[model samples]
Target: MPTARPRLLYVTDLAYPARGRRYGDEDVFLTSRLRAEFDLALCHPGDAVSLMDAFDAVVVRNSGPVLTYPEAYAAFRERAAERGTPVFNPLTGRGDMAGKGYLTDLTAAGYPVIPTVDRAADLHRLPETGRYVVKPRLGADSAGLRTVTPDALRAVLAEGAATGADLLAQPHVDFVHEISFCFVDDAFQYALYAPRPDRRWELAPYRPTLADLAFARRFIDWNALPYGVQRVDACRTPDGGLLLVELEDLNPYLSLDALDDGTREAFVTAFTASLRRFLAV
Candidate 1:
């Protein structure tokens, strides 16, 4: 008899319409490849809590913003924690998975992150810039993101965390380019960049310098997930340096189609290995 493969509950929303990315195609391509090594099953994010128990582990990928279904996501988290289910990103992510609040935390800790302030009273902490970015503390994919003058920003801040409206404010960054470092667990897989800041989805392979690797690895080390996929996004400042833009740990859309066949295969191989390790734990 053949050895039984681990059963995996792959959570995704194939119908999600991402602005600059194709969430469906990437998940489709990945699950097709993943089928070779695991007894894989796909389900929407809303259904994960109900069906996850039968699987060895749950692999959350491109399930769309949790904001769309916060209650379901919360329930999933609660159930997973209750059962100590091994989630791929390991529910321990402190980055975007948990919320954008980490931006404020990272800034305070003096990580090379964009200065983020959660309180309106703390507006003075931000740099004197032409404009400021105001977005929901739990925002994802630029949802509810906006810009305003310092005066307008103050008024919004004065409203004061009314109910669930607490916002994150930052000096609008005029960066040269945006880049992302993809990693599996703690191992750096590859880098990609968008030359034009406006064209975020038009990505190209980026060859990272030693310094670049050092910067990206700082956050990966900080996140400390033993097994999972992560992407450290950063932007090139006007002074020719990179600052942490975001650390995406939960269901980050891997632009697999952007990579060459070899690179894609390498990622899949690494992912397969990582999943096996996670299941064993």
Candidate 2:
């Protein structure tokens, strides 16, 4: 007799109205393909905690921003950890999965990231720019992100300090383009870029150079998640250098629609294999 296929609880917010991208379509496409090898059931982020135990593994994909349901997300993480349930993107991710605090940490460590400061006292560390970007430490999908003049930024930082709100400030970077390197378990898969900064989701396939791959790999290596997918987001500065913008380790959108049929099929193949490996562990 054949063995039963692995059961997977795939979490997603199908109706999530994400700007410039169809969250539902991407997940629908992914789940449809994933069902081929696994016994999969789709559920919303809010339902993951209750349903996770019944499945062999939980695959969080396009679940939307956790900020929308912080308590539920926190509970899911806590419960999953306590039970030692296998969660794809393994709860061990240190990038966006944890928070934006890594930005400041990376900056302080001399990584090629946009200089970030979480406290008003560290404002002098940033380069003098006409404007600065202020974002909440736990922000995702541009939530609580703001651009302000230097004085306003300083005032805001001071206010945040007084209120004890976690915030990070950085000099606004004037970059030529934004690029993302997609990877599956430390292996580079593919890359995509938004040529027009104003239209962030209008993505085009980008062929990464050796240097670009090295730049992205540095962050992936730092994150050090032994399993799960990651997308290393970066911006190309005016001087033609890549700087880390965001490292998404939690439910990073694959933008599968942006890839041609062959590439998309390849990604699906890789993703399915990764899931099998994750469950075997």
Candidate 3:
């Protein structure tokens, strides 16, 4: 169904200033590698709806947080869905791609996620910890997040819930390490971890054991996305177990530069292949 080379509209914000991540550099590197197999054109997320029609597929990469341009992003999604355009991370992702509401659902369902509750009535569900992490259910990149003690949570919830602003409150997790598993279309590519909990971006290659793989795979399989990339972010608890922190099925920042050459190449190959297959459908 494709010609000698497929055409891709790669969506990214080349100038987005992420706190500790180089969104542009990673996209430059990825598009460079991808160009070898496909005819690619880069565009900011805002322009995707305008430019997407000409390409065989639209590859939505590090386009920054949707909160940056919520209305434009909504328009892009509406147009794509209306036209049945092929988006790489198929618009059906149920994790962060959808919203953080899954955290509350998963918490109620007894998943190993950090306990989350939104309503004032649900406040009692959370563990009694010194402080709690309260964040917008539709938030990204830590926007509008606050750390509050139990005494103040009630007042915050009263205001937050009244505006239909779904909120998530979780006890501050004391973890040994934060690790992430990267996957392309349900296949695990590699794992990385931040040894120093304080330095979230200072990562190193992590070789996941069978148990680790099993833990990550469960969430991936649960997501059941036949295409698109997903990142399973977890933290090693003090009790020597992994707890799901977030399922990043949205614009996950791939730290490819941190990986070894071989690993990086492998991921690129897998990603390119997955994109090809996804576009074909």
TM-scores of the candidates in the order shown? 0.97, 0.97, 0.97
Tell me the lDDT of candidate 3. 0.90
RMSD of each: 1.7, 1.6, 1.1
* Segments in model 3 whose C-alpha atoms lie over 4 Å from true places: none
Residue-level error in angstroms, candidate 3, position 111: 1.1
Per-residue C-alpha lDDT of model 3 across residues 175-237, encoded as one tens digit per residue:
999999999987889999999999999999999999999999988888888898899999999
User: Which 10 residues in a row give candidate 1 its minimum summed lDDT?
Assistant: 155-164
1-281: candidate 1 lDDT, tens digit per residue: 11278888999999998988988899889989889998889999999999998877888999999999999999999999998787888888999998999999999999999899999778888999999999988898898899999889988776647665878999999999999999998888999999999999899999999999999999999988888999999999999899999999998888887898888899999998998777876
Give each model's whole-structure lDDT.
0.90, 0.92, 0.90
Q: Which of 1 and 2 is the better model by lDDT? A: 2
Candidate 2 has what TM-score?
A: 0.97
If both were scored by lDDT, which would come out higher, candidate 2 or candidate 3? 2
| Position 281, candidate 3: lDDT | 75
